[model samples]
Target chain A: MKITFAYWGNYTIAFISLFQKLGINVIPPEKTNQQSIIEGAKISPEMYCFPLKANIGNYLTAIKKGADTVFMVTSLSGSCRLRYYGIIQDKVLSEAGYKVNFVILNQNFIDIYQKLKKISGASFWQIVKAVYFFFKKLHLIEKLEKKAQYLRPREKIKGQTDQILRETFPQLEKVRNLRELTKLKREIKKKISEIEIDSKKNVPRIGIIGEIFTVTDGAINFGIEEKLGKQDIEVHREMDVTYHLKKIICPWKDWQIQKKINPYLKSTVGGHGRDAIFEMLNYTKNNFDGIIHLLPFGCMPEVVIRPILEKIHQETGIPFLSLSLDEQVAEAGINTRLEAFVDVVKNHYNNKNH
Target chain B: MKCYLGIDVGSVSTNLVLIDKENNVLFSLYIRTEGDPISAIKKGLKLLKEKIPENAEVVGVGTTGSARQLAGVITGADLIKNEITAHARGVAHFIPDVKTIIEIGGQDSKIIILENGVVVDFGLNLLCAAGTGSFLDAQSFRLKIPIQEFGKLALSSKQPTIISSRCTVFAESDMIHKQQIGHKTEDIVAGLCQGLARNFLANIAKGKNIKPPIVFEGGVSENLGMRKAFEEALKEKVIIPKYNTVMGAFGAALLVKEMSPQKSKFFGFGVIDKDIKCTSFQCKGCPNQCEVIEARIDGKVMARWGDRCGKWSNLNMNNI
Candidate 1:
């Protein structure tokens, strides 16, 4: 293992494949596990957001497996801890006596593959091709998840939709170009369309808006979307790698969203904090039955937005379930809260329809 | 008479309830779980067996609480539900117009807001038990008073001391400082109740509508001091059901009845005599390393769970 990137669901493999195209041997991160979380927590400051600790866990594990370089995700925006995580993590890693090369890339990799160019010293055309491949593959993964979310709640069999995700995500990792990606997309849509579904099932729609990592990484949030799907709830998440990429490609989009959030939030508090308010209001306007806000415990930006989320809930009257999670939370406890949220959402949905 | 049975296997206590066709609770028991829900459930079922008429049949059985899944498998429950849903239904069963429910259990607490007999919102104490029954239990032991009489003693305070209840440890230390500084024990106890009520309303019930017909249930309802503190803080009356301690089981029974299963799957009182064993393993098939739990009765596996992937949980454990 020469280097490893912060694992982001299917996108983890996409990152690895992108770098592998550049002749960098990066092991796909071992899916975030208890061992990694524990390993990460042992060295991390107690109150650091879960994603940071998890990254530490992944890097330490990768180092143990002979990964000599750490390709870390960071930001230049100083509004959140994300901008400084690379520096802090670099210090911590060096202090731990692990001599490793650090390649810090902003999360909006599409607009800034220049960092990769600088590191790999690759030709501009070569870097552009690798970035395009990574972006295309990421978009396809997002599409698969969207289709699965829709079908999951209505599938006649509980696990059929899941079976598709479980089997197809790996097949997606093998996709090399736009042609193969298109073919896989069509086949996935065909498979999903073929899944036996009762379209008339009374499913409540929920919008999930939160910190990117906790929302995107299923392991950290305990696959909350799947849990909701099992209970006949349609989950629509607006925060993902693609969403971030689009926002980065178009800078003015933030200004538009910031305008909507101005009354609720004085300014962009950084990260998804502002995006969450925008998403909640969006969900309310769309008549979503509820919204679930996921944030790592004590995450400053997300935590600050919590009260604003509550205010929005009060004004909009759409039910809201806010879950601040870390390793301290048990899956059983999360399941119970989700069950309760669904029950409430279902009741609210039914009453409105009648 | 045919009756529905509800078994609630919680962290601190196990409750069992028997309700007739008309929703009349015929038998109810609240016993200490004592860290062994299996044995506590068996004890409740044995006691129920002894009390019921010989010709009476258990038409349905339901389970709820933290250990609901475990209890459901052991008792062959027709419906297994979360405690929040069960408690809401239980309260609405008595007070159909119930707008709010404040339930404080042994290890956790919850605030449920209901509108028109349907739950609209709810919250559970996420991190740990801060303001709950366990804290009060520990306090009563330190005071050398029976837990049963703690609430009554608290009600006797003339000038309740001011205390903090944000964290249990902090609250305990605050209570001792008050006690050493010439505060009466009764006053300190009353302050603890008030602090708990304020914490509950502020944290778990934060920003929710506090409407009337609010019902308080669970083991903590027996603590009269808690009710007073709630009533004082809300400036509205708080109602407790007749079988408050067993409300979780009562609601579960009512829900199973509503499901109207064609046949009951209850193991009956015979489960009391069965030897049930629970075992767990860390699965290495995938990177997740799910800790799968299996329950067996007399060497025959009945059910398995706790796996994120369905591989282990979906396996026919009976065959294994």
Candidate 2:
């Protein structure tokens, strides 16, 4: 079966490698753009979350490119609307007269393996190796991204880190084995480190915590991470595809997040609501200058947690900027808010020092 | 006779203020932007030259507001700050103990929370125009009431009517419906003020710790009715500083005074006569398609910005 999945930053590369290793035909969704969002929103319900619309758009674009089967990661139980996205997306697609099969995977490892076995006819050991390769690449990409975040704000030349990262992603795709991957990792690290960065520049450090999709998707968030980096603010984002996968594979992380956020939030609000609070608290304790919470318009979990985050801000005296984004959100509006926010944080820092 | 110049180029109005070494306002001018910020700054500078003392020399310059970058480039400002910081600085200079600042301008409204003369938090209206000064101005025009008399009419009402300020369209329709019901004009005006104040409090000041010693500044603060509405809504007295309309410009001037940069980037008031031109084009280098803006002075490119990749911006750096 020809399969396709939505893009989540560079995570698509790992997915392609895994599917290729299993000898399955995988059609990656077209790069997200204004056309994709417009197409996705045209058929989607008005109040559905942005990720759903974008994901549906991706599937439609993939289908147009000849993908007959779609793969989606779903949850069985959650207050977040994400769990219901699979059924709604399937219904929406079929109603649009597209005949396609959808393979939905939950947190169950055995269930995913069984589905893959039926689809790809791959040996159990080969499937395991593919999964191993997927994770290894994911970890490597995450490391590279973290390094870029550190270097972007301090780079003597603007956009140098971005330029290096843009070139590194394709190079990562060509790696075949552990030895090759390690060598490439070192080479990319050296290349990124070689980018000249001003050592004396004292930049305000910002931590971004929010919904997974909006946090990872640059197009949707208006490239906020890059915008902050361009403003010479060191932005550290904790949510990524690999981080989400790790939490899914190991449920103990959720327990720890729950415990840390227990005093503020009594129960899970579902999705990343609990996790957002945990991450904000973590950043606050670590002496980060500011916390930016990004959520899609009408996201229930995030909406529920916003006030709590504000309360944390009041209690800690650390500035918190909550940006709710929709397709209608203007780039100028975002830029102005970010500029004002950066000013507030910098002024606060300067005042504290004096 | 050394002076520091501050220019605030907002969407609705462009304000310029000049201050001396003692931070006393030497001269101030407020003019309608009319959608042309460069021309507005030039006109303001011309007026400044005519009004200021003959011997006064501009030693430092600062720019603030939405068009700060454009103004900074044209004026060669020593510092370019956002309206939030500028407004807060301007007010904190006058009211050092202010804990909250409610600034409602023509196109946007913001709430800045301060502590001990430092900004701790701020919120700006996003994609909403209901609680801003332009909305009130538009309503005044629709009602055939002079904009200057709007506040007086609102204050005279004994019982304000209830108007829905959730959206501008809804509020206009609601006002018409109230008028049809034979409600007095003053009552409707007061109700609109209350609705706007409520909207500002609900959205911009939502979940904010608005304490005492709140200073309200901006063009909208000139309306006593809106100030009363805010007072009634927050159940706390709000102080409107003397220079409410030009607070942003005043703040910018104060910030530059505080910094007192060793080398001022002021290009002098002669920039008012220079032939400055700005052009924009979309860059096709990547998918972002950033609209690169270029500013030219006397037909020579001085600055290029708005590119996401910094490709064009780097080129302008060499020119500088």
Candidate 3:
């Protein structure tokens, strides 16, 4: 079978290596940025959810490049209205005059191997090689992201961490061996630390929680991390769609590194607020100055967690700013909150020092 | 000698279950909610106190369902669990090989997917009212038939019509049209069941891969007609457990029993009859104006919640 892999952002290198190992065509989406988010939301359903619009936008761009198939990971349980994402997007795309086949990879679904067989038309050894490479790329990306987080607040100039990350990402795509990948990981980490951060200034550490994809990807949050970076505040984010899906596939053992952060806080097994509640307590106990919980509009799980988190803030006296993103994720609105939050955290530290 | 108490407080029904250390069911009580959760809980507690053995010391108490928090504070619950975990645990305990759970309760419906005793994927509908038990109850009321008899009535039908199941209003209007066309009540009831089944399939069951050995429970599980409709739609037999109605309560009790018995954080049985008052105030901390609800017991704040950011209620340390 002739297959074309479609994805958003810079994940093209990872998919290229994975799909190439299987003798399949790996197609990259248009480079994602702030403009793509606005354009995507405008073209798609106004209320379909954030991840959906961005993903749909990305895939639509890739399909324009003659890509015939889109691969999306769907989790079995969680507040990610993302379970029905592939089917919904598939239908919506068809309605909008795009003819493309969508391959949904969900842990809950049985016969995944057979489904892959149907999509790839690859030999047994070839499929195994592709999967092995895919997982390897995943591990590399995770390592790179972890190092990226530690660098963001510490950088001398705002966007330095992002600049270093952007430069280092392409170098990772060239690596072929596990030893090479390990060295690259160490290099990223060391490079991140070398960027001068104020050692004497004890800035308040704030966490951003809620909605796996939107929190991690800068396109959805509109570079809020960079805004916080300018204020010398270390921002910790704990949601990743890749980690959520990997955890489902490997329940017996840890599949992602962040699991070590809080092993007890699992995904909402019932599609509820348990993850938020557990994370809230963990963030509070860790003595973080505040938390910024982000969620999509009409998210049921976050709706339930709102009261619990409000209670957490009440108990811990932690300043929390909750932002619910939908289609109208304007740059001005985002920057206003980011600037105010940083100011509040700055004032908090200043008062504590006195 | 160990005793376990399980309570499920839902929007429409309150259920209580008593199980011994061996997990043997000793007593079960299910009652209507009537909008006042506190009153329903009081009635349930009174019935439980009267029915259970006086000397049987309740070693552990567990609460589940939508009102699990409120029930936990009032009943001194040792464990508070969500409906999904409770249902999955209860089903796994009773039938180890259970793979799927289709629970349709009052005001809500859920689909639980389990692989090797752990929940892999689950879906619930709290937004829509089309496929839930309350939808069936309202339809039954509109048809002037008791809910229990509606299932049997549906089974007697020969031909069932395909009515609009997207919205409740559309379904009711379609049902009225079918009635005017001289259709049999049994057939119309059967058609309604099919409509609900179709709605569940289109909405909650979309993109879900349903496996066999499915267990159907909750208030709507009593509807044999709906069970047949689902079986026919999926081309697989639906399995209904012995104590399907109280599965959430049973699941909660089982979870509590799994833990080492501890002093329950329960407020005691006196809380059942006590005049509990609830008041709300708009928080002026910011522009959000989050309405914080405070529950007072004997003029003391026992529990406070309902804020969007926890600025107001998180300050109350007396209850914690």
Candidate 4:
């Protein structure tokens, strides 16, 4: 059965490989862009959060390219909001007239054993091997992505990180042994460390804080981090696999961190939006030149976060910017804003130097 | 001789609570935000300065809320907390036996489930504004009644109508339909409160077990109408703390009192009254229209923020 599966971002590469090992055709959503977001948003409910629209866009884009199935994973316990996204997305896609099949993989429905049986249709031994192989590659990719973060900051050449990522991700699919995966990780780490970082000039140190999906995933956020990289600006974003892992284990840490930092401005659970506001304030007090806050459009946490951020910027005498992305985000507009910010930073740098 | 100050600066209100060396609130003030948090905070500080004795030395200051960071910077807070921890702390402190906390503030509502003083599971309603104080404010405006009087009006109802509260627009239209049907104003007001309560339960409380001693707090805690509605919906009695309105601030203040300060980096009281000017520009950083805002005090840049990239976050400090 030419069962083709599609997923959203770089993390899914390992997921794709496991299915591929089981003789399944796996495809990553084509590099996401502004048009895709708009196209997806046009079909999605206007009130749905931004990541929902972007994911819908990814699936729609895949289905349009002849991919039959899309996968959505969920958590059964913490944060019901995230759990509902998969079901909602399925209904939303069906409403949009895309009759493609959705393979929902949530902790609520399928256990680890059942998932292995359903997806691979293999005996216990075969399933164990496949699972083991998948984790080996998964661990490698996770390490690579982390190392990539450190390396990404070093690369002076524009799109060097992008080019390297594109080449390295696909090579993971060919890994049949643990040694190959281990070798791949070590080489990638070494190469990444060698990438030169231009740290002589002082750059603004901005911190990003927001919802997990929209913040880390580039397609939903419209290539925000990459764009910042081009401006030769050091970006200090905390959203990644590590943060998501933390959310799963120590769910209240997000709030605890908020509690730790926010008392200076507001004393209440302001939500993630409030956390972002505090982070921005921290950045400002620490002498960060600017802070960027991003969320999916109509996102509830950000709604609370936005006004406070506006208030924080107003009160503390700090430079802050906000972007809300749904499927309809325009890349050109985003790029324009980035260029203006870079120009402003450059102007400040020039002024300071003279 | 040493005292502490805790401030909770929210979108709709700014709260200040002065804790004595013993963690007791000596003087507390709650001010309506009125679309200007800085002004509200400044006014809060001014009120704090006047109310407290100068000899009661402020040993530590804590800040929390949506505006905690800005508040921390302004107040020189020694400790800061998110509203959840602060609110949870407030509930745990006042009502030691409390199991669940239902907090409906100006812009959002949350249900914190606690088991023996530790938070087990919690739910926050982020998508809908059906249960928030702002929603009640809008409903009050539509009904041509003061927001403070909404609970009183609901209490007077004999036969309450059931208004659809799935969406605010739908709820408004349903309310108008009920009015046309000649339902008593008090009944309709009661229905509005019930609708908000139902909406909140349906959205955030699906399948979650909510037990007592339930503490209802935040700005909306003052609404007897909503409180009654919650009781009817949950079929259990809800408790409201004495200083319910500023619980998050109080909780945050309590947190600061509990924790030893690393150091007081507070900018001092003089900074609160400064003529700070804030300006924003659309960041042309990539295709993201990040509105980078800059804060200036006395014609010098005091801080810069509002960009996704740290492109300009912490680079300049010529005493700015």
Candidate 5:
């Protein structure tokens, strides 16, 4: 069966490796763009979150590209709209007259393995090996991304880190085994370190926190991380595919984070709102120069957390900027706001020194 | 006499201000952009030449506003700063104890919160024109009243009607409905001003701690009705500075005076008569087809910008 799934940063690489190892044909969705967003928004409910629309667009594009089976991950326990995305997408696709198989994975790891075996006729040991390779590749990409973040603000030549990171992705895709992966990792590290950087530049540190989809999706947010890096601001974003996977695997870690946010947010408000609050507090304690909270427009959980964030800002005297994104947001408007925010943060940082 | 020149090129208006060594305004001009910033800036410079004393020399130059980059390139400004910093600086110079600044310009509005003479936080309206000066300008035309006299009429209203300010389009329809229901012109006008005031408080100043000694400046600050509405809504008096219309330019001049750049980049008023042209083309290097802008003087490219990758920008770095 031809299988397709939405792309989420570098996690698509790990998924491709896993399915290939399992001997199942995989068709990855095209990179997100204006076309995908338009197609997705056309079919999605008016009030649905941006991620849902973008994912729908991805699925539709994959279907047109000859994929008959669509795979998606959903949460069974949360009250968030993410839990309903799979079923809603299924209904929408069926109504659109597409003959496709919909495979929805939940928290049950055993169930996922059984389904994979049924589809690919893979043995338990093969499945375990495939999973091992997937995790290894995912972790490696995560580490590389962290390194790129640090290098981006300091690189003497603008866009040098991004260019190197883009080039390394293909090399990563060609690796066949653990030895090759390790060698490739070492080579990439050496190349990235060779790039000239100003070690003495004192740049303001900014922590980005918010809904996972809006924060991590470059196309949706208009390349915020790159924009900030170009402005010589160090950006720290903790939300990523690997981090999300780790939270799912070790649910207790999320509970520990939730504990820190208990005083502000008593109960789970669904989605990533709770996590955003926890991360904001952590960044504040670390003495970050500023914080940017990004979320999709009409996001219920994020809207609920806006007031709480204001309280936090008032109490701590830490500057915070909230950006609500949708299809309608203009790129120039975002750029202007970011420029002004950087100026304020820089002035505040300089004033503190004297 | 030595002076520092500052230019604020906004969407609707372009302001030029020259300040002396003692921070006193030497000459200032406010001209309508009329969709051509280059000509507006040139006209202002021509006027400044006639107004300033023959002994005055421009020692430093600064540019601020939405089109600050373009203005800086044309004027060879020593410093280019955003409107938030420029406005904050201008307000602080007038009111040393000012803690909040409410600036509503042609297309955008902003709220700047300060503590101990340094900007602590600020917010800009996101692609919304509900509470901006342009919205009020449009309504004045529809109401068949001169824009200047619109605010004076509002002050005569005994009881203003309640109008929603959630969106400009919605507010316009609401105003039409009020007119159809036979609401008094003065009451409707007052309602519109109050509606804009509400929109500013709910959107731009949302969650912001606005304290006393707040200064209101920008093109919209000229509306007496808006000032009174803001005062009534917040239960606090809003101070309108003397140079409210040109505060951004005034602030930019003040900043350049403080900076005291060793070599002033002031191209001089003579550069305004030069033949400068700007054109843009889509770069096809990647999927993110950035529209790169190029500025030329006498057909020789002088500046290149708007490319996110800096590919084109780096090419003209020497010229800039």
Candidate 6:
């Protein structure tokens, strides 16, 4: 079996599972780790964002594990550096002397279908089944993540909620249909509802917003949601696979966000610059305690939108903390910032109620 | 007599401060951390053991700074806080109406904005630690002037030269170039101070409503030259608080005092006598291959940390 795979993130299960159903010998990419990062960083541009570096790391590891072909998803002209991610990685991999087949999914529907047809030798009907299953699994993954987010701080035992998520994720890969998902959903919901919780606990709620990759991928942002949840802060974020799918299926949602963001962001600078403002407004309107903006070191959209975020913070008087992540980010620094941010939000929440 | 102890373990220095129940700073000691926070903390405790009255019982303990976690573990701290909160808390204790806090420490600098005695927002040095205390320490070493005198000399120069404030490398290189061209030492020093002040404003203080009366507290605030440069730039006078150098420790004391735990978790002066050691190694159990660090006291593990999986961190301790 010639192994084929893509890099990992919130979309890993969806991407790998879809390929698996097509009879491709797919080895799931390993979790982002130190060895892979050091290898990837050595061969990549010094200033590449953490996501790109992480992808390169995973690709190198995939090749080491005897992967013969790889496919990756990319955006086109998001006014962000993401447009060039696949091209740059392909060049870097070729230079490193890898002979594996490479594929880039730039959202050209017919081209993607044709590529799949060529690679898998599957009929049009088969590819359709695989892709439809992909959307369903993506929705399931996001729903599971959202449930875990809600239950983490409220769980009876410290690691109980995360343990549920840990158990359910792999089981999801084997699920065949909406009926199975519904059965799994009921079983999980029963377990969650049965878990003891202090419904009266008044934990400060915080919204996580900013760059999609960093927000979606826990390893890169150092498991911020987990850390915040552990601190007795209820964490909420709207930038998941389903929300992004909505942006793609109904770009009117983005245009609506862009319209609201125009006073702050004159035009789309790519990769969720407009969505960031719209989300910030959403959190504020909902009377959330605080908002944390996670910006990858030199990300164009994030850097450009920083001042606007600050202005909103000033006018709104909501405690906002901007955390920038890079390869050199130390866990201790993020820990310190989060601890202080919790204090700020709790204080703000208390003041509002009084 | 009873007291609350606040210990701040930082990269360059460790500060221990004692405060009364009334929240008045009673005794404060600032000493070089010297790369080993354990010894520095013990030494601080030893000196403190000698000075404080025999009847002075430590009823509460707080820890803050970069090594706050380690210090909290060693001291049995009832309260642990970050530098920003500690600095703000300490400043608000003295000047209740202060609106902004500008703190520059050994390795980091931050601008904290407060409204009504509570910190509302803050900004830490991003991308670069260009003009922090360590940056000043380096310039002073290269210039062959005492750090204490670096600021004094800068205060003497009327016309400060212009130097790039983009980063520490360029700023120091510019200073050396200016010196070789026969620029006065005072002028170059003054120029460096101005550059740092400018950098802090444009970077850390950017978009932060740096309202006065701004309280500047940290090791760097002791530099009179930097103070003058800030005043000239903001066109508003900056006040250096009474306990400028040890404000973080001072604030920790204030926080613990305010929290007022029934009984102190402090290990007492006897902790200085224990044999403490730390060792780290890579765990090959999984692909993450996390580097796990173990802190020990006489071959019994006090703490095991630095692992992504709970397998290591959640393990039961056995004598080793």
Candidate that would win on TM-score: 1
lDDT of 6 by residue, A66-139 (tens): 88777877887466788888888888888888877778877556667787788789887888888888888888
Alpha carbon deviation, residue A194, candidate 3 (Å): 23
Alpha-carbon TM-score of each model against the true structure: 0.97, 0.93, 0.53, 0.58, 0.92, 0.96
List, residue by residue over B202-229, the lDDT tens digit for candidate 1: 8888889878998998889999899999
lDDT of model 6, residue B276: 78
Candidate 2, residues A12-34: lDDT per residue as tens digits?
77888888889999887866666
Off by over 4 Å in 2: A60-64, A94-101, A156-158, A174-180, A197-203, A351-354, B269-277, B297-299, B317-320
> Order of all candidates by DockQ, from best down to worst?
1, 6, 2, 5, 4, 3
Docking class of 4: incorrect
Worst 10 residues of 4 chain B by lDDT: B118-127
TM-score of 5: 0.92
Q: List per-prediction Cα lDDT, in the order shown.
A: 0.86, 0.88, 0.73, 0.70, 0.87, 0.84
| Candidate 5, residue A161: how far the Cα is off, in Å | 2.5
Order by TM-score, highest first: 1, 6, 2, 5, 4, 3
- Angstrom error at residue A4, model 4: 19
Q: What are the interface RMSDs of all the models?
A: 1.0, 1.8, 18.5, 16.9, 1.9, 1.8
Give the DockQ (2 decimals) of all models: 0.82, 0.54, 0.01, 0.01, 0.51, 0.63
Measured by lDDT, the strongest candidate is 2
By DockQ, is 1 or 5 better?
Answer: 1
Which scores greater on TM-score, model 2 or model 4?
2
Whichever of 1 and 6 has more lDDT, that candidate is: 1
Tens digit of per-residue lDDT, candidate 2, span B1-320: 88898899999999999999998998888889999999999999999988989889888899999999899998899999889989999999889999999999999999999988888899999878998999999999999998889999999999999999999999999999999989999999999999999999999899899998988988889898998999999899899887899999999998898898898888877888999999999887765567889998888787888876678877845545
lDDT for B147 in candidate 5 is 89
Q: Score chain A of model 6 by TM-score against the reference chain A.
A: 0.94
